[model samples]
Target: MTGFVIRQLGPADAAAYREIRLEGLERHPEAFGSTYEAEAALSPEEFVRRVVEVPTFAAERDGRLLGLVGLARESGVKRRHRGTLIRMYVRPEARGSGAADALVEAVLDHARSEGLDAVLLAVITEAEPARRLYERHGFKVYGVEPGALRIGDRAYDDELRIRFL
Candidate 1:
């Protein structure tokens, strides 16, 4: 994690954010719900709006953006006690170097600071490394959503995990 900086992203980071995000969706279509084609069509202004609206954290090293993770809280009063962890991605070169760890920790820290009761996330059932990462951070699988995502003619299941703050 040395030389890596984990911080909240702003509007100025939209281009970099969009690049990394699209990379993730493109490189691993089965891992995310969003399609690369869908996101690629979005304008820079939309990314800027996302930067301002979502609580997203980015990992940077040597002035280059390496990864991103987003935290979203529920708007309903009854669901306000929880938040969702979304869009976690790290460049392949940065994997196992603690960049993913840093990004997730940043989200967990932010959740605690916001007084949220818990944070929930969904991982593709086949992604063992990601599941292990979340488990090591105290997340427990509560359920599995079979056929949660359908891409083309294939179906993918998602494991739902949650960690109480």
Candidate 2:
């Protein structure tokens, strides 16, 4: 595979973004709060609005989107200094290609550019590779939320991690 570049996603990328996002939610139900069925029911305009509103970034290779991640800033008066990293996923075929790493760095870079004091994210306790990636990026586990996600009969815990800028 050729090299991939990470860049901010926009409204124009709504369709592609929706495709990969749905794939992630379907393939890894415990990894996200939103369900594939719920997102699949959303209108195209909704996807467009999401890309327009959220600070999303994608890994694109040869005109095809391989992975994506998003950052959401805290809105409260006292919490405005921080942002949360959300919806991080990479295509299975793109694993080990540095797509995940690049996507993460892009979000941190965006956070820094926005003058945020810190960035936070939650990874499922069982997702070791993902946890290692965040730890390598200087994120430390602050806490763990038990039964953070319930899908079917299974409960998944999430490790809350944060990186100070």
Candidate 3:
């Protein structure tokens, strides 16, 4: 936790990123929009493409990845000023080690560098810890998206939040 490094993930980090990504999806299915099965089926090249296409930041300590977060900029003419934070996850053992906070900060810093006026993200309504994390980083809830994600027979609502840079 003391010497963790936060940096942008590149092609060489695809494998580590994929591993932690799948772990997050599998362990907390309700916390993510993508399913484990879907991501698990993706080819190695696809994971490489993902890290290249999306601006992803990873937290690493002693050569091991601890967490990651991605910032996807909007492409539309009107929405180009905004970016969405996605695929945020920190390894279970890395929680409370400042990895999550560092990841979120990296995303925001990248958003600013890209000239984004705002950054948006949606957290599961029941995930109070995640919600609090966002709030502590200057994000404020603007609305609640009812039943944003559905896993099997259960439905999960999402809290929509935004931070203006």
Candidate 4:
């Protein structure tokens, strides 16, 4: 994790986002709301627009992308103070390392800079390690949606976690 560059992603870095996203979806199919197949069909322009428009950060080492996280501010005037955390993925080799922590911190820093009051995320209940990571980051599990995601006939509960910035 040391010597890795964690920085705000720009238009040129859309490919990094796409690559890590594909890697994530392929490795963890039931871990996200989107599918790898659908997301893989997106045009480069669309990918660039989405990544550059939102607050996304990436970890790189030796000029190779290692991980990434995305933070999307809530829309509508009433929800201006809220943000959503999504698309957090670290290469398996980087797990238990500090790469994911750095990416999460970068997202939180971006939330604070954007004047957001809080950030929210949903973790599948069965993902114990991920739940612990969120807890360590000051996120509290406030609620759960039973059978939130149905992947290949299997139901998974979603645990909602939030933190005030």
Candidate 5:
């Protein structure tokens, strides 16, 4: 497939997006802090509501979801100018095909439209590709949270990144 067709996610895409998310968690449990079981147990309504709240985008190729990305605005009044990039996942088979890049850009565009001053994200230290992707997009590692997520017997370090829009 050529570049994936990227589109803003709507309420109707909740299930498809959820499936991609679960697949990502299953394939790379160490990359993300979330688990497949944890996401699957959430009701569809919850998924839809979450999608509605955050600006989400999906990449599709040949009718299959290739990637998804979303951002959540900070809740506190003083921190409302900031937003965090979350739920960024690309199908393992679709890596380097531009799907993930498109999804990330779409979400970042949404954040810019919302007048966000900066965006933040936590990338697992060992995920070199992921870290490089963010760096390519002008994100710099501000700090690292040691032992961020405990997955089974081991712990993963997370690097905090920030990009000013």
Candidate 6:
């Protein structure tokens, strides 16, 4: 953790972001809704657009992008007080290195700075480590969404978690 640095990612980081993200989608299909086939076809320009449009953060160690997280605020006036945490992933080699914690902390810090009232996230129910990680950061389980994501013939449940800031 001491050697890893978390920072905001921009268009310049499109390549690294794409690599890490594709890895997540491919290596753990059930953990994410997006499929590798869909993401792999996207052009570099699309990745650049994502970096420019989304508020993304990354944990880097020795020039390697190990973890990533994205935060998005609701657009509707009624839901503007809430933010969504999305696409959190840490390279397998970096797991248990506190990279996920650092990325989550960065998101929470940003949420506070933006005056968000709460932060929400949905994780696969089978992802025990991720569920525990969120719990350690004050995120509480609100509900379980059945059949939240389906890959081929398999359906995965998602647990909705929220933290009131």
Q: Least lDDT summed over 10 consecutive residues: which range in candidate 3?
A: 1-10
Which residue pairs in candidate 6 have backbone atoms (N, alpha carbon, C) closer than 3 angstroms, thus clashing?
Answer: none
Query: Over the stretch 19-75, how does candidate 1's per-residue lDDT look in tens digits?
Result: 999999999999998999999999999999998888999999987888899999988
| Model 6: per-residue Cα lDDT over 1-165, one tens digit each | 559999999999999999999999989999887889999999999999998877899999999999999998999999989999998999988999999999999999999999999999999999999999999999999999999999889899999999999
The residue ranges of model 4 lying beyond 4 angstroms of the native Cα positions read none
Q: Give the TM-score of candidate 3.
A: 0.98
TM-score of every model? 0.97, 0.98, 0.98, 0.96, 0.95, 0.97
Q: Best by lDDT, which number?
A: 2
lDDT agreement of model 4 with the native? 0.88
Per-residue lDDT of 151 in model 4: 84
- List runs of model 5 lying over 4 Å from the truth: none
lDDT tens readout by residue for model 5, 1-165: 575798888889889988888888898888777799999899999889978988788888877888888898999999999999998888878887877777778877888999998999999999999999999888989999999989878999999999999
lDDT tens digits by residue: candidate 3, 1-165: 568999999999899999999999999999999999999999999999999999999999988999999999999999999999999998888899999999999999999999999999999989988998999999999999998999888999999999999
**Model 3: lDDT of residue 144:** 94
- In model 1, the runs with Cα more than 4 Å from the true position are none
Candidate 5: pairs in clash: none
Cα-lDDT of candidate 5: 0.87
Cand. 6 Cα-lDDT = 0.94
lDDT value for candidate 3? 0.94
> Over the full model, what C-alpha lDDT does candidate 1 score relative to the true structure?
0.94
RMSD of each: 0.9, 0.7, 0.7, 1.0, 1.1, 1.0
- Model 2 residue pairs with clashes: none
